[model samples]
Target: RPRPITPPCDLRLQSQEVQVNLGSGDGARRSMMGDSSTLLSYYHEDAKTMYEVFQRGLHITGERDGPFLGSRLPNQPYKWLSYREVSLQLAEHLGSGLLSQGCQPSPDQFIGVFAQNRPEWIISELACYTYSMVVVPLYDTLGPDAIRYIINTAEISTVICDKAQKAAVLLENVQRGDTPGLKMIILMDAFDTQLLEEAQKCSVHIRALRDPPGPDDLSIVCFTSGTTGNPKGVMLTHGNVVADFAGFLKVTDKVIFPNQDDVLISFLPLAHMFERLIEAVVICHGGRIGFFQGDIRLLPDDMKALRPTIFPVVPRLLNRMYDKVRA
Candidate 1:
């Protein structure tokens, strides 16, 4: 007989893998759960057409209220803004500057997002849509080679990343000829006089991006984990992600109701599709997104401050949470 399964266990969970259900088919065929499906009905109509699920959703207000995740931390307090406020700001930013001058954004133009998790990531993505430029997100855990591959593959020119991740970009590969298209690298963590000086020295331009990226344009590029050979870059166009977005909304709606000011704590790597989709949902709903002070080790303390309403995680991470709760 096989050994009996024990009730008390000491199984340790790794943090690399995240688990989520991806729906079948492309943009037109995909069925998303949660708020995604409801949002998709209006955005994605054709059954066979590949389309981007942009624009979080038509703005709506709910009666319930609470402290959103990013409302206040440290010296801050909980303040809420409706979905309309956030998405409109995204639209306004996209319409500014060189972005609005063209029918289709130049291929030489590219935007990179290198943050951990926060409103900046979503805002940056939305701005890319307005300008019709492609948004490339970097994995925090990726080595310099992987990072270089993404940059080179996409021919990325402008980049927006966290201050903590700047060193990686400045390392041997990036410093060498590995990255050719990289021009601007903006640090999201820049807060004080030092950040301003860094910006001046690096000649980094810090401002909101404008113009809603066309629905048919490629919105984001996600690279798969190179489990076999070189990692395959999964090109998720706006439609591809939007389909998943709708499917996610369909499933999510049956379980919980979301509001624009709802608090969300994001712990997954933003490069992953699930996290990116979740970020999109958060943007559509108009909620506050809180960046953790550090890694998973510091999330508990951060959680106390953020008090997230919706939390997404891989099975391993969830198992760890269960273990901690039991302890």
Candidate 2:
């Protein structure tokens, strides 16, 4: 007979009892977690789609812009991006531009976004959401081959990139016929004329976004890091992403929900769900978000500049900070 192994310590403390009954109180009522343990939604309308989440903010706030997105240069303070322009006007223009460029406004229509945490990235994402299109994000660490694989797999037609270099990468892919589905490459920043001619020769349209309304089936086709093997794309619905923010909302609604006064610093990768959920929560509340200056070593400068109200922290970061303060 085998002897029972003792635990290092009773890490699993006694489970506490709850006050609510199944389906009687708020949140989702699941039997395993007991009555209303799960959050059904915290959205005022219980926003079922990304379109509604974007619209819900406007409806609640009565169309207030009030400095939404922010960014900065090296050692410079964060500059403002108006909420009315980004959340409303730019989205509409981009969505209309996509439609004009022959891209359909459907859930199956995928748009690629290859960039860091910037206003343009979120603006492009909002454009997709507003037009009922799916967003396929390709981050920097995703190598050339993986990027090609995603573009083909998702049948991505329009790809919005941050800078000229990323647009060049897509153009090269087009030149070699690696991305046949790719037709339009939208750069978020200025590019020289040489690149435009190169794009023209490759039979691809290139434009800078100075530039979306609707229900989306899939929210994001977020790819894995391919640590084990090739990267696998995970399909998430609008409800799936919104539910995360809604869960956050349910937790804070009674105490403090984020308003226009709230500010978030988006240094974390939106490729991961953590940052995406944080952005979603803030966006639903018309809160401000500031992007770091693309360097972790200089994040303290950004911290001083923005004085962000929200931070995406893990135990590791907290531990490091604790150690630094202790030292």
Candidate 3:
């Protein structure tokens, strides 16, 4: 069950000086203007890598006890995977499973993730980071032409999709030779022997990467929505994402306190930076994240079941919810 929300402390900006130590033993200090009006002003020394942030959370949460990711079935109660369970699955199952099958991604290679907000998506992202592969997130709402353009632009040979339907679209492109470089389509839901056989005939291997990615290496290539024209790819490194997490903590620590017991409901697409950054923050703070069922109609029921402590929402969703309440 989620804890009741507590009133947030008043947040205001003032002026002072404070020392920031970067976890180094040396008394090296960097002075920065502090907020004199609010006692909640705090900053986390920047982490060198996204992996370090994850490691910090695992250490803090002790891995085995609490829920890290939660989801639901058609009529069953929410299912949970603990931090330890998730980590072991990533390291032993998914990572090695891909590698053994010859799915090795080159350093900083672009791999596509076409899926909804599920635990598999999170595992896949982490697996890519572990192998130093750059992830290209594909929005589920994107049309076929747009998807083809991004895949070609990124030169993605292998993609991980949540369902056979999504994979079928990519598979069709592969067969037509439109996406010549595309070699494999990994479906998260169920194994399709026919697809595997077809991929094999096309000489594409279904696999994972051999080497782990470093902090400074490229982590994601996020494509902007092609509202006016074709989407543009934004390259982000592990350091860049870690910096964002640090910045978020520095600013919101006072008003938003997160801990092991915190529960966050995720409905926004993970392809968007806002949701992705919030996911990283929740993981860093040792909180649980629950994904809403893909249908918007089920959001209300899902929310009631999950009982999320923190709701990170966009203005559109907020406006709709407000209208519903007023009615």
Q: How much is the lDDT of residue 26 in candidate 2? A: 57
Candidate 3 TM-score, C-alpha based: 0.82
Q: Which candidate is the best by lDDT?
A: 2
Q: Local error of candidate 2 at 108, Å?
A: 1.1
List lDDT for all candidates, in order.
0.56, 0.79, 0.74
Evaluated against the true structure, the overall lDDT of model 2 is: 0.79
* Counted clashes in each candidate structure: 36, 3, 4
Poorly placed runs, candidate 3 (over 4 Å): 1-46, 103-106, 191-193, 197-201, 205-212
* Candidate 1 runs further than 4 Å off: 1-58, 61-91, 94-108, 164-168, 171-175, 191-211
In lDDT terms, how accurate is model 3? 0.74
Q: How many backbone clashes does candidate 1 have?
A: 36
Model 1 weakest lDDT span, ten residues long: 46-55
Residue-wise C-alpha lDDT for candidate 2, range 139-216, written one tens digit per residue = 878888999999998899899998999898888988898998899999888999999999999899998788033323
lDDT by residue for model 3 (1-327), tens:
647544333224232344656577555432232233343211344345565556656777882457889999755678988877777765347656656556565554787999999988888887766666678999767778889999999988778888767776787787788888887777777756776676676676543221655667888889887569998888988777876666666655665667888888999889988888878888877889999988888898899999998778998999999999899
TM-score of 2: 0.83
